[model samples]
Each structure stands twice: as structure tokens, then as C-alpha cells.
Target: MKNDNVILGIDLGTSAVKCVAMSTSGGIVATTEAAFPLTRDLPGQAEQNPADWLTALELAVTRLGRDVTMNAVAIGLTGQLPTLVCLEGAKPLPSAITWMDSRADAWASSFLDDSKRQMMYDRTGMPIDGRYLAPMFRYHRETFDNGVGTILSAKDFLHFALTGELATDPSTAAGYGLYDLDGANWSQELCAVWGISSSLLPTVRPSASASGLREAVAARLGLPSGLPVTVGCADSVASAYAMAGLDSGTVCITSGSSTIIMDSLPKPLRDSQRRYLLTPHIADGVFGREMDLLSTGTSYRWLNDLLGWENGRIDIAAARSQAGANGLLFSPYLAGGEQGALWNPNLRGVLHGLTVQHSSDDIARAYLEGVQFEIRRCVDILAEDSKIERVVLAGHAASHSATMQMLADILGRPVAAYHHRSPAAIGAALLAAPSAAHSKQMPTDKAVAVPSQLRADYEKIYRRYCAMFPAIAEAAD
Candidate 1:
């Protein structure tokens, strides 16, 4: 039977645009996905067309095959953030500079110094990488004829596309590395340094704030013209919300192209590891500590493509391999610009202990293990809550049994995967729910128990992985 009360949740991810329709009485009634391309046309340049996101979103919603006009009470959205979505009014000027791109490094270096970087970090709750809004503003400022009018993050762009409103929440705003973390507003001095006028920044609002959809957009999408749209948050915060605990007791890991380990923090905090960022959670007075690995699934994909295997898919070959992958070790930093502990933009991925007997399968297993080791490393730095036992894992990359079990054995804690396919999208739906404080739908139940057998071997290999980073990074330096 169809539930009368349903909400549409959409997330714009690096690999695809995902939608989950949830009923108030039932759990997730329907889910849909439409894959989109994230291209690297040049080295250190990751680009995506905003129009493609819109088309993919429409297709996914159509695939849901639900009567949004009758059922969907509200629409909630979330997306990858700090994405430099350069816009003139509602239309994108050209390619959106995604979070993965590092082309703004040259401008960042010229504009920021040791003292200045720390100053910006204090204001933004993160150290500036080339990915932030300020660097993008400075780097590509001269490329446009009219000059870039307004820069918005992925979720912010989606909101504007739906409601014709230019606004963002603190979660996405902080990702730009120019948000006043203390003031909860745009940083005027920081914007001045990057030649970004504060006037161009969107109006900041709390996540879950509401607006009515534009009539034209609603008619085109086959929805009610004045349907309520809840302004949602960034992907990391959404993943945290899906974990079902917005307090200090819960920890969530969103493992995708990048690995993001987040914990609900009570107040504003910073880690000694400069790359570990602090951002406001969607809920008021809640904060999140996010430690990110730039390339987790990206490393896996690269290895798969290098061997000419099926792309965008991981197989059981990794599980068939031994715990240590025949002594092979990999550092999963192939994509450059790591947000993890080292904070090194030039850090390169390394593979050690390859032998003639080792198969491509062993290498694949090593790649998976390598990313897990980095997760353990970053989690140790960002997680202040010491009494935690397990991590709630979302995102497809680390949700696999082999990957989760390896992570469990590595971190010596059970890994709980969301029963639902798209927890991030579900989190967005929660934003639209009447009670954002609770969920009527579901709970995270697919917990991957840690096997004691793999611990001894994994612990030894993990040490070697950690030990090798210094020598390899030094050699590159």
C-alpha cells in the first residue's frame, strides 16, 4: 500500500545523483539513482557541469515513479561541498570547480603565508586547501568576462535551482574556508584577502529552514508549485545525522571517493592535525569534527582501471586475498591534496612489497587495506570521544563486508553499515520531517562484526603501512 505522507530526499554526490523517498509510517518507500560524470580534463582539475546535475536529478525523480504532487510533502537536499559553483544569476558560467580540484594552489600560496593560513584556519575551522571558495575566487577571477557574480556550494546551488533563492547553511558555508566560524557569518577580512566581496556570499541560514518551490520549476518537475522545500546540509553532516545520534556518543564514517570520519561535537573544536576540520552540524548548537581522506575509492578505481578490470565496481577478489595481501602495502593518496593528518598537497600514493607471485587481486586487496589504515590514522586524531566502541559506516565504498571487516579488524571495533542504501539522502529526508530530532523510518542495523582472526595480521601490516609513509613522503619531498 502507498503511504500518503512521503518526502523526497536528494543528494548530489561525486559519482551520482541519488534520491530516496521516505514515508512517515513506513521506512524508505522508494529509492532512485542517476549516474553523472565527474571529469578531470587536466591534471589537478576536477570539473562537472551543473546542468548535468539538474538533468540527472530530474531523471532520478522520474524513476521514483511516485506522485510527488499528491504524496511528497516536502523536499530535502544535500551535496558535496566547498565545490566552487560559479554562478551568474541561476545559470552556471561554465564547469563547476569540484572539491577534488587543486588548481587554486598557486594562488593560495601567493596569497597565504604560515601566519595567514593559521589565521584563516582559526576563522574557518579548517586550514585552507586550494579547494576552498576563496582560492577559487582568486584563481579564476580573471577568466570570466563579467567577473564571477556569486559562488555557491553544491547544496546551495541545488536550493537555488529549486526555489530561486540564494542561501546556504553554516555546514556548507564553513567548507568554503572563508566562513567566520566564531561569528557564524562571512569573514570580511579573509574575503578581502582573496578579493572575494562579502556581498557575493549567500544569506546564511540554519539547515532545515523552509521555502516554497518556484512554480515554473514545480510544473517542469511535475510537482505542486508551492511545495515546501527544506534547506538541507552538506554530505558529511547528513551522514552524521543518518547515524541516529547527534551527540558525542556516535561516530559516523562516510566512505566514498573520499573517506570522511565525523563525530558530533558539543562545541567548536580544533585538532592539532590541521587538515581535520570542524563544522557546524545541521541542528542548532551541534558541531562536527570531520577528518577526511582525499582518495579512498578513487585509489581503488585507479587500481581497477590500471589492471583494465571493470570500473566503478569492487569484486570479491579482494576478500579472496590474504589479510596482508601477500605483504603488499599501499598508501591511498593517488589523487593528491589530502585533508588527512599530514596536510600535504604533494603527497603521492605508494605501493610497497610487490612480488612476482602477487596477483592483481592481491594488489586490489592492498589498496582497500591502505585506505582503511588511513581512516584509522585520521580517526585517532579527530575523535575526542575516547569511549567509543564502533563506527556507523555510510557511503558505498567502505560498506562492503570485506572492507568493513578489514576496517573492524584494523580499528579493533565493529563497523555498522546503514541498512538503507543511501543514508545521506535519508538524512536529508529527516531534515524535512516534522521532527528533525527523531526518525520514524529506520535504524542502522547492518553491523559488521570484527573477526579476531585477522587482527594479528592486520595490526602488523597496519604498522608497516604507517612506518612506510615517512620514508616515502620524505623521498617525494
Candidate 2:
């Protein structure tokens, strides 16, 4: 690989599309982002037009400048998962149902009995949830009384728009809730359970598989025609590839709108409690064991808006309060349900022990602590099977030293903050780079350590949070 050549990684996120250019020498040449609005008017609904993703991609690449845009190199793609995109021919039907949507929660709760749910978890390694693509598709058809068409994941839809290919990678396939984890293919039995035809889904391909860029899109984006484009994995998978690269036991938490706690496993490991999700990793012979917290970053943003405080103010306010938030406890389940270490969809956010003495700063601190408590729950589960040798934090929210320190204090372990704004985008770029260049070391911020004096307080707080959770969940039930 020539040092001058650069690979382009386009990451379609929950709210925007981010593009990054990386040289063969493993340095980021340039980066740009374009935001897109998420539709949330309807209750228990979250959606976006697939067309918006393409527009954002074009806007992002155009912002990359002509020189970087025209750079002679391959392209790779990554994006959020389980976002159902229905298409007729090559055009999207209407809106793509995102992972956060919970319209099928009621149906999933009623239709999937305990026996059936266990069977699903055994087959697909996914807890039977309404947020998955299969259930979401079922809900879409029944509610709208619409006829069926082709089905695709969010990234697959983007890939088709970019290269005119109708295919999906394995990591994305797992999001369908019909993919057989053991067989590494779509499970007919599981599909039968949902009354879905496998033919509707795109053909599964390898994450690093390559396809030629469509000449029309190339001309539109000012890039070379027929450029090699790599079909990438899910955003979480891509970030894991960049940060750890098949190195088992190194857990990486990519915190964005949600926080995904994941690590590589040489073989699939199932949790008897079905707390974590097991899926295909970025490459063959590797599996991704992950648990997602659906409301970590979302809670922060919601609190900021509610308080009319700017972005970083919450973190600074959190720093003003001590470890336990002055006896206040917050449950960061603002996303209507919880995922990491808990699969209860009935759960909602709770503010416990609030008092007149409590200030906005205390609330902010408690919310941050609540998120860390959830992460600790996940980390504890991950450690149950394998020792967590290292904890690396990545994503938009990973750069905050104070927040990262709080996490370290909660987990009683050093947490290394990845020194990148978008690890998923960089990981996608790495997928396009040559195998030799994959060895480039990912830069990380200094590890945050738990203060010695506060260890006892942190431990006590974690215990109290754990004790309070079952009662809270029981009430929701």
C-alpha cells in the first residue's frame, strides 16, 4: 500500500452521516459530518427516510473538499443496525424503522411466550425484542396493512444506493432476528416463526467484500467511477475492529446516542439469562458479544435540553457534585426500555430520593452515575465469562475526562478513552485499507483511575443501585 493512497469510510449514524479519510500510514487526513433529522412525532416510533442518508452522505463527502473526495482509493461503509429499510426495485418504500422504535413491544410481549423467547435466544442469540428488524417488519405490515417488498438493513440500503448492489453483510444480517448464529445463515425455522420469507432479505456477504461504485453516484459525489467499495459491518462491529481487532477480552464501549458494550470472542458464548446479544463480528471465526444501553447518551441530551444548558455544561455540573450525587439516584431508562443487562421494555426513567436540597448539578451528577452503573452491570456480566483485560471507550461522548473518570470509579478499573471522534468511521476505513495497514495502533487517551479515598463510596453506591433496580423493574412490570 502506498502511503499517499487514502481510503474513505462513510459511517451513517443515528442522527447524521460521518465521513473520514485515512492515509495508508494510519493517519486521518480529513473528516466531515452532515446531520439528518430523526422523525419522532408518533408515539413509540422512530424513523428516517432512506433517501436522507444518501443526501447526508453526498453533503458530507462534498464537504471533504475536491482533493480528498477525488483521492484514488477504496471506500468502506458502516452504519446503525436493525433499521428496517423496505424497498421496491431500488427505491425505498417510505421510511426506515430505526432500532430505537418500539411499536412492536406490545406484540412481542404477547406473541413471544417464554418458551418461544428461549427458543429464539437459543437459535439467534438475540433476546426476543420488538426493536429487532423481524418484529419491526411484522409490526409495519400489520399496522399499515401494506403489501411486502424487499427488506434491507440501513447499511445495506446505503450500499445499494452507492454501488447498486443488493446485499448485506453477516453482522447486519444478525440484526434481522432470523439469522442462525451457529449456522451463520438465515434460519428458516426462525423466519417461519415470524411468517417472513427469506427471499425478501438480501444475500449475506462478507464484511470486507468489495463491489464497484456505480458510475452515476461517482459522478454525483466527484469520485472515481467504478472505485472499489467494501461492504462493511455494523457500526459497533466496525468500531470493535478498529479498537481491538479480534483481540478477545478487550471490551470497547462506543457511546453515541446509545452505549454499546462489546468484546470479541473466539467462539460464541451465550448468556443463560439472555442479557447480552451474541452476533457475528467483523471477520470470519470471530463472534461479537455485546450488550447495549439504549439511553446513556440520550439521557444526557434530554437532561441538557430540559435544563436549557449547553452541551458540556452537564459534565461540568456533574463535576461539582460528589460521587453519590448527594444521596440522589437516577435510573437512565429514558428510552422507554432498557437493554444492557436488562431486557425489560416496560422500564422507564426514574429519579429516586430527590429532595428540596438537590440542585440541577446533583441531578446531572446522578444521571452520569446512573449511566455508569448500567455500564458496570454490563461489564460485570462480560467479566463473568472472560476476564476483562482492558476497557477502551470510544465515540462522541468518550472524550470527556470527568465522565470517563466516573466510569473508572464505578467499575473500579482503569478506563482508556479512545482518542478519536468517530471510531466507527475510522474502523470502516480500516476495513478498506490493506491487511498490512490494519496493524496500526489506535491512539487512546490516558487511562482514568479511581481515586483511592472514593473507592468505598463508589462500591457502596453500586451496591445500593443494584438493590434499588429489582424493585424499580418490578414496579414497571
Candidate 3:
């Protein structure tokens, strides 16, 4: 039953590596995932040996069965971006930094003056922060002062590994905080400002551009050499492309290790307030309006681990626990910044109205509510900027019925959860396909309607959630 018409999509995410085989008919043939193993090791630092990511990707693709590769016409790559990687061609000079690290803060502050920082934000659609490439690169340039390597994002490294081509997509490049959004290329002025050469970065390429896979790499993975490979986008963008109908009027929420809310506009939207991140979408002239929440699924997973709920058992607690988690209110901030908020990396999680009477179930449910409430807040911000009548939810958090229902009720809008477990990979596959005309990635029939029962209840608690952010800030302080 092996067919050569299938394309492979590789998604290297924060918690895992997922490789999916999708057929020409747009149906998924197989998928496999490998969990994270590399270390955070230090506070404000997260590093992974790049080799581990490749090994994990190989393992997942390998598990898709030998036939998938034998049949895989092309491989599309996507992963976390703005993470630091110093590369000596195919070999990494140092461990790849995860997006979670803030070791670039001092470098960012020293490199960007207030005026230049504002220019960078306006042009790049990203704030001057440690999660960006400029600061991360500066940290390496100042610390090790290494002159032996080039800098690339995680997916760029993967594409280089596969195709021997050092390149990045406009979508990926826009997140680096180095590229010129208006010019759609690397900014020589900014490079001069940072006292760095443009040679340090990858060449810009279209997202769907393809190259022949390298012989050695192909042989290592048991795939044929000269296989076609697509230069894919970042995970959030890919998820939006794969799952959401972004041709105006619709918004997408990719709820995974983080929560990413995005919309598509005819042109890029710049926020002088520095509240949103803008990036080019897969479609020409269309922009992806994006915001991030660092700990959405992570928050839910954290509570699940605390409650000792295994797999599908989590919904039971979340579903049974009434709205407002029985009077317990929670704000999920298990990590650094809760992007789309005040942009405070020091923000902490808060659980108010918690009493001995509340069980772990109540706490878990409360955490779920907290994350969706944050999404509601983000969508509201987006509405102020543009019109969004409907929403499409994708990723791990979106799969749960309770979470979807909660989101729909809280937002008071129709919320469609992606049917596919790996929308980003599916998205990459579409980009890898030989022809642009393919089956519908997201059929409207798959959408779910909002439940009316919980809207009023959630509206009441949502106000309470909004009121708690200040108190949460005080508690964190």
C-alpha cells in the first residue's frame, strides 16, 4: 500500500519533533513524534544540542515507516524561530538555544538605542527583546566572540541540513528582528548599526522554494538522494496556513506549548504600542497578524502532571469542574513572557480564591479557563485593530472538547478546532506539494458550533479574570 505520491512534513517544536506523511489527496498517511530531551541547564537559558533535534526528527520520520520515505516526494521543514544557533556549515558551532532563553537581554539593550529599537519594531513587526536574533547573535558575538560560523534559526538549520542550502523564508526572517519588513530583505543599515555584516545571516528565499536533498543526509535517513524539499515557515505560520481559512474574516489560534493567535490582512499591520508581532503570510501581499502566549498548553500540561491525569483523563476533571473552577480563578504564567500582554517576562501564575475545599480538579479546570481567557483578551485586541467574525483553533489545546467549548463560550464566537493533530506539518506538506492546487486543508464541515449554555457564565468569570491581572502582577512582584 506504499505510494510515491506522499510528501513529508517535519515540524521541530519546543516539546517535540513531529514528522508527518501526507498524500497527494491531502490525507495524512502517518505521523510520529519525539519528546524533548536537551537541557535548559541554567536560569534564563535554554539550550539543545542541534544534533538531538535532527536525531529526533529522524526517529519520528523513521517511525513513519520506510515506505513513507521511499514514497516521500519532498520534505518541508518548520520549527521554533529566533532561537540562537551558531553553525559551521552543517555542523553547529554551539548548542542551539531554545526560544525560552533570555541570555540575550544585555546584548539587546547595548545594541539597540531607543530610536533604533523603535525603528526595528516598526520595520520588523517585532519588539526589541532577548528572544529575537539580534540580541541572541550579539550574546555569542560578545561572549565567545566566535568568528568561525554563521547564524541561522532552527528551521533554517534543518533546511541546510537537508538541502545543503543556507536560506530562510520571509516569514521566518521577519521574526529575527533583523530583517527589513518593508524591504523584505536583510537591513544593511541595521547590520551597520549592530556593527555586524549581512554575511552572518542566511539568504532570503520564498517559503515554498525547493531544492534537491543532499546525498549523505538522504542516505542517513534511508531516503533517496535528490529528493525535493520545500523551505517552509515557522510553526505558528504553518499551523495557520494549514488549518485556518485566512482569506479575511477569520482568525487562527495555534494553542500548543504556547498560544499563537493570528489573522491575515491585505497588508501588514504595525502596532506602535509594540503589542503585536507582524510577519508575512504564505500568500503574497497578505500579512499574518500574530501574538504569542508563552505558556498555554504548557500551563495545562503542568496542571495535568500535578493532578496525575493520564492522557484522555484530563477532560473528565476539566469537564466536571463547573465554570470559574468552583470560585477559584487562575492565571497561567508558568514561563517567561505572556506575549500579547504587558510583555513582562517576570509575570507569575496566580490562583485566587483557592481554599482547602478546592480539589486539584478545580485547579486544573481553572488553569484551562485562565488560558482561554487570555486568548479572548488577545482576540479582543485584534478586533480593535481589524474585523474578525470567526476563529479557527489548532494544536494540542484545541483538540479537547472542553477547552473548545470553553473558548467558544468565552469568546462568544464560532470556534472550529482543526481535525488534524499536526496542522503545521500538514501545512508544510501543502507547501511541499508539486502543484498549488490541492484538496482543502480545512473543510468547513469540520467546524464546531459554540455552546450557548456557558456563554453567560464564562462572561461573568472572564471579567473576574480580567480584574485579576493587576493582582497577579503584584503577587509576582
Candidate order by lDDT, decreasing, is: 2, 1, 3
**Candidate 3, run of 10 with poorest lDDT:** 436-445
- Native-vs-model 1 lDDT? 0.79
Ranking by TM-score: 2, 1, 3
How good is model 2 by TM-score?
A: 0.97
Error of 1 at 201 (Å): 0.7
Stronger candidate by TM-score (1 vs 3):
1
RMSD of each: 2.1, 1.6, 2.2
lDDT against the true structure, per candidate, is 0.79, 0.87, 0.79
Q: Over the stretch 1-477, how does candidate 1's per-residue lDDT look in tens digits?
A: 374678888999887899988876537778999988888878788889899899998888888875643578889889987788888866886688888888887667667778888888788888787888778767877876675678888889999999988999999999877789889998888888777788788899888898999998887777778888877999888878877557685678877778788888678877544657889998777888887888776776777788888853454677888888888998877877466777777788777888899987888888878878888886766545445655877766444677678778888777777757677888888888777424553577655656578888778888888888867776654
Which regions of candidate 2 deviate over 4 angstroms?
Answer: 1-3, 143-147
Model 3 regions lying over 4 Å from their true place: 105-116, 436-439, 444-447, 471-477
Per residue, candidate 2 scores C-alpha lDDT tens digits across 135-211 of: 98887776543445688999999998988888888888889999998888999999899989998888888989889
| Local accuracy of candidate 3 as per-residue lDDT tens digits, 31-97 | 8998767577777777887888888877887888887778878888888876777876557865777
Q: Indicate the TM-score of model 3.
A: 0.94
